[model samples]
Target: MNGVITPADTLGTRLTGLRGFYRAGYRSVLAYRADLLFGVIGFVIQTVLAVAVWRVLYDGHDEVAGVASSTAVAYAVLAGCIQSVVMPWQFSSLPQRVFRGQIGVDMMRPRSLISQNLAQAAGTMVGRLPIGVAGLAVGLALGGVQAPRSLLDLFASAVSILLGIANIMTINLLVSMIAFWTLETGGVMILYRFASAFLSGALIPLWFMPEWLQPIIGRLPFQAQIYAPLSIWFGTRHGGELIGTLALQLGWVLALFVLLQLVWRRAVHRVVVLGG
Candidate 1:
């Protein structure tokens, strides 16, 4: 068996390589600490402004769509924090790589492209933690935010947030893959930003949305990314409902994974045909 790698050994090696990629991603983010700090400051400002707007809207009302004004403020804060941490908009470098003719070199690497990108995304999320925590603290200080109703709710929120981050990353990967054919993804990126902000409930909770629109938005992956987790934190979703929501998030993650694979294969074929 000397100098021979078994299947298990190969799997272990690949896992180790992926871990390295994750660490590299984390380090890269850390290297831009100043930029991250600025981002945190901007995020805190945005969260505060959002909280103020919602507070004003609910000034004369106890609740809107069964959610208290205070709860809405909390949701706004938490949603902003999640967005800043995951920062899905920044996840995809594939477009730039394609534009610069560097994607060919990336494709030549032995690593699985999806796994490597996922690792990097995981790293970026890790790197954003300090900023996220700071932003959350600021949101709390600004008032109108509430603590999780119970330990269980808190746990559920945490789990949902992790799933949400995964969902966001998958969506970003899918969007970036479009570069394989178009080679210019600026418009697509802009469209994704607007769509995600609205549909993900970052700007407004789905509960406040039109009743007819609620069902449609609920079924979308965007809701899984932000709304579901925030709902868990706000105690709006619980027990079987909480379980169902988390299940939906998991389903989206799996579905997106399969879709990414299919799209990546076609993208690679396109790249090859274009002489990449």
Candidate 2:
């Protein structure tokens, strides 16, 4: 009985392994203190600049597309901070490791590769949380970020944010898994980041986009990543509309996770080592 492991033990072991990956990922970000400092400074500057740009756009108008100028400014500030924390720029290190023949080591680990990667990504996001918080503080000081319209709005936004984070991590994981076939994804990763920024509404809100394009973007998973939660926070989405948006986010997260599994199965077989 002592030598035999129980199901609960097995589960605990697996969770412990995942936590190791999370801590490693988190510490890696904090290892370079200078980078952390500069990163926060850069993000603060970016948030402020984005806020200023939105203000300029709304210079002579009280509202555009039924969204008040103040709302737009707050959206920009929060969007920038959210984008900073989401950190879509790097996407994942999978493609690079694959190209370098290091993925074989990852595959050899006892845990599932996808779970490990997601845990690491979550760690990295947590590590960068301070930067987002600092940017929000700046926004608050500048009067660019306002309180939620109501407590319900706050609660709904919080749930949507979690879903949005899952949607983002899953989508990015799918992108990273592309390395199994391509072996190198520098150009593709860059392109994906650019497209995500626009489509996710981090660069420009859907309200400001062309009339015909708004609904189309709304249907995409990218919108669920940043726009949906922020819109909920802004009180633009509520009632049945809020429920629908959250449902869509959950749907995309589930669908993307399924797609990730399919891709991962093929990806594992395609791993390339440095030598025979």
Reference-based lDDT, each prediction = 0.86, 0.87
**Per-residue C-alpha lDDT of model 2 across residues 167-235, encoded as one tens digit per residue:** 889988898888777776878888888899899998888988999999999999999989999999989
Off by over 4 Å in 1: 1-11
- Top-scoring candidate (TM-score): 2
Model 1, residue pairs in steric clash? none
List, in order, the clash count of every candidate structure: 0, 0
Clashing pairs in 2: none
Q: State, as a TM-score between 0 and 1, how close model 1 is to the true structure.
A: 0.92
C-alpha-based local distance difference test score of model 2: 0.87
Give per-residue CA lDDT, model 1, range 1-276, as digits (tens): 898989999999888888977897788778988987787788777877888888898999998878888888888888888887886457666777788998888777789888888887788888888777887898878885789999999999999988988899999889888888887788888899889989999887898899999999999999999999988887888678989999999999999999999999999889889889
lDDT of 1 at 168: 92
TM-score of each: 0.92, 0.94
